[model samples]
Target: MADSVAVEDPKFTLQEVLDTFKSCLSENKEVFLEHYVAGWLGLVRFMNSLGSVFSFIAKDAVNKIQILINHLNGENGAHYVTVQSMVKYELDNQLVDLTKRGSFPESGCRTLLRLHRALRWLELFLERLRTSTEESKTSVMCSEAYNESLSQHHAWIIRKAAGTAFWALPGRATFFDVMNVGTPEQVVAMLGDALPLISEVYQVTEDLYVQNNILDLP
Candidate 1:
């Protein structure tokens, strides 16, 4: 199932990857978790192209994706159709451990929240990349993005590990080249085209979580 929608293109381009995410957004404003996870899988390939430094983060993200994949492939898979549907299904059936980990340790609400928070960090980091100068530090930009978004959810050890990884990030020039999007100017233009869609998806999911009172789900 994962292979069918997976971003398996060997010659992966950042624009192509981002576009995969953009496709995840449905006209009805409900995001299918399958597509959303596949989008992250695309980003993971991009990160891997940057180098091995980001492997830790990518590995953790893969685990989260796999967990959601399990739910989508489970007996009640029909209810896991969209983010909103999954939340409503699980909540209505008392399948989620709202306040803490219980029978369902990997609740849809909590899992999606983790991905949602990381999406904000990705959006911030990409925006910084888009506007950055030749001398801009990817490490600093990445750390700042993490600090603002995902840091709160991470423990000190994981945060410290991530910080170490950020410091090893390639410079703006290398980062731009890895995107495989023509020249530097073209890369920025591609990002300009991508950011808004990503931001829209992030904001919509955020509002959904907030309205459901599961934004801070444990």
Candidate 2:
């Protein structure tokens, strides 16, 4: 199932990735699980392209992505079509181990929360990158973004390791070039256009988790 949506083209741009996020949103505002996973897959590829320094983060994201993918392909997949439906299905079936991690390690609720949190980190980091000037340090911007978002949910060791990895990030020029989207000006414009969609997806998921009282699922 994952292979069907794998991005193999070298010409993959941030624009195409953002479009996946846009497609995730239906007219009724429900997020389609398939497109959501594809957006994250694009992001994981982007992180991998950055180099091995981000491999740990990318690997963790890949695991979560696969978990959701499996749910989408499972016999109960019909119930997992959208984020809202997945939440309702999982909670109604008591598939989620809300208070503590026990069985159902691959519950869509818990798995998506991890990705949801990571999305916040990306949202902040990209916003910082978008507004940055030529003199801005990418490492500093990344660390600051991490601290503001994902760090709160990470263990001390993971946070320490992630902080060390930030120092290895390429310069702003190289980073923008890796995006393969054109000039730095274009990168900023693309980010400006994309961040809101990312934020909306994050917010909608956040609200769902909060309303279900699963925000702090162990």
Candidate 3:
């Protein structure tokens, strides 16, 4: 099911990767970074669904996630042991290389930060979508999420691209339909189940970045 959805349909593939993350949370402490973070390839294809503008942002995020996944899957060295450990290891070793590979937002910290930041948007938007009654709008939810999460520090182009996506969002029915989930009620229930895991992952990453002072780089 996942394999078919992922191929022949790029957007569905990305969402599938995100769904994989949700599935992995069942592993908790046993979660392996290689599989956890290696899903970026699918996500990049998924973002490509909206349009070209998001391609750059999605690529950046995918690039960073892949780096972590590689280090974890590699041998001959202690890879990032935890989200917290990874942050410290990268920053302390100067692996981040932010501005001119020195200032801020090194590929590592910066890209994860994007996903971290987007989590808040997802929470807000999902919460809204959850309680949404009476002709709710995906565009509004998406826009609200972007404004709250991914917009402030991003370049104008990204902000504009994000905004464009929000506006381009399909209505609720179409949106839910694309999710390939069940009825609205069923979807909401599933979201309730899935969101906390997503939020936990986000919070874990956010705290790591903030404590490491790597939140603003890129």
Where does model 2 exceed 4 Å of error? 1-9
Top model number, TM-score: 2
- Candidate order by TM-score, highest to lowest? 2, 1, 3
TM-score: which is higher, 1 or 2?
A: 2
Q: Candidate 2, residue 215: CA error in Å?
A: 0.6
Q: Which stretches of candidate 1 lie over 4 Å from their true place?
A: 3-9
lDDT score, candidate 2, position 216: 84
Q: How far is candidate 1 from the true structure (C-alpha RMSD, Å)?
A: 1.8
lDDT, residue 80, model 3:
51
Query: How does model 2 score by TM-score?
Result: 0.96
- The deviation in Å at residue 179 for candidate 3 is 0.8
lDDT string, candidate 3, 12-44, tens digits = 632466576665443454333444464445545
User: What are the per-residue Cα lDDT tens digits for candidate 2 across 1-218?
Assistant: 55334534566677888879988888988999999999999988887888888888878888889889988998999999999999999999899998888998889999999889988989999999999999999999999999999899999999999999999999999999989999999999999999999999988889988899998877
Q: In candidate 2, residue 112 scores what lDDT? A: 94
TM-score of 1: 0.94
Error of 2 at 46 (Å): 0.6
Can you list the residue pairs that collide in candidate 1?
A: none
Summing lDDT over every window of 10 consecutive residues in candidate 3, give the lowest-scoring window: 1-10
Q: In model 1, state the lDDT of residue 110.
A: 81
